[model samples]
Target: MEANKFLDAKGLACPMPIVKTRKAMNDLLSGQILEIHATDKGAKNDLTAWAKSGGHELVKHEEENGILKFWIIKG
Candidate 1:
């Protein structure tokens, strides 16, 4: 997916990915998408839940070569 911002949170753990994702999302306008690349396994669930709770949309996600990629559309 095309995103307005790209956040590389690779090599980070747990809450750090979510923390950075939140901060990056804050910089986006409503409807803009933030693409996040993280290595933390927990980020999959955490980011999905965070986006839902924040009224954002989790457009898509995938894991490749030990990396987790997420696309979140700002609400």
Candidate 2:
């Protein structure tokens, strides 16, 4: 999936990835995508929940080489 913006949250833990993601998403318009790369294992659940609660769309997600990649569309 393509993204209008990218956030490198690799190596960040806990709330940091979500924190940065929230900030990045703030700059996007509705329907635009934000791609995030994170190494935190908890980010999968964290981001999924956050996106849903925030009314954003969790478009796609996958893992590769211990890295978690998420594609979220702003709602």
Candidate 3:
């Protein structure tokens, strides 16, 4: 899906991906989408929970070639 901003967190681990995602989301307006590319396997669950807790929408997510992609709409 289309996104307003893209955050590449590839090669990072754990909290780093979520941390970067949080920072990147700050640059977007409400309802805008932030696309994140992370190699951390834990990012899927971390981001999903983070988005839900922050009231943002986790639009979709998938994995390919060990890369995890997520689309989050700013709340």
Residue pairs with colliding backbones in model 1 are none
lDDT tens digits, residues 1-75, model 1? 788999999999877998888899889999999999999898998998999999999999998999999999999
Residue 2 C-alpha lDDT in model 2: 78
Between candidates 1 and 2, the TM-score winner: 2
* Model 2 TM-score, all chains together: 0.98
Top lDDT prediction, candidate number: 2
lDDT of 3 by residue, 1-63 (tens): 888999999999887898889899889999999999999888888899999999999999999
* Consecutive 10-residue window with the lowest summed lDDT within model 1: 13-22
lDDT of 1 at 14: 79
- Give the runs in model 2 whose Cα sits over 4 Å from its true position: none
User: TM-scores for all candidates?
Assistant: 0.96, 0.98, 0.97
Task: Provide backbone clash counts, one per model.
Answer: 0, 0, 0
The candidates, ranked best first by lDDT, are 2, 3, 1
Candidate 1: misplaced stretches above 4 Å? none
Give the Cα lDDT of each candidate.
0.92, 0.97, 0.93
- The clash number for model 3 is 0
lDDT of 2 by residue, 9-65 (tens): 999989899999999999999999999999999999999999999999998999999
- Show model 3 residue runs off by greater than 4 Å: none
Query: Of 1 and 2, which scores higher on lDDT?
Result: 2
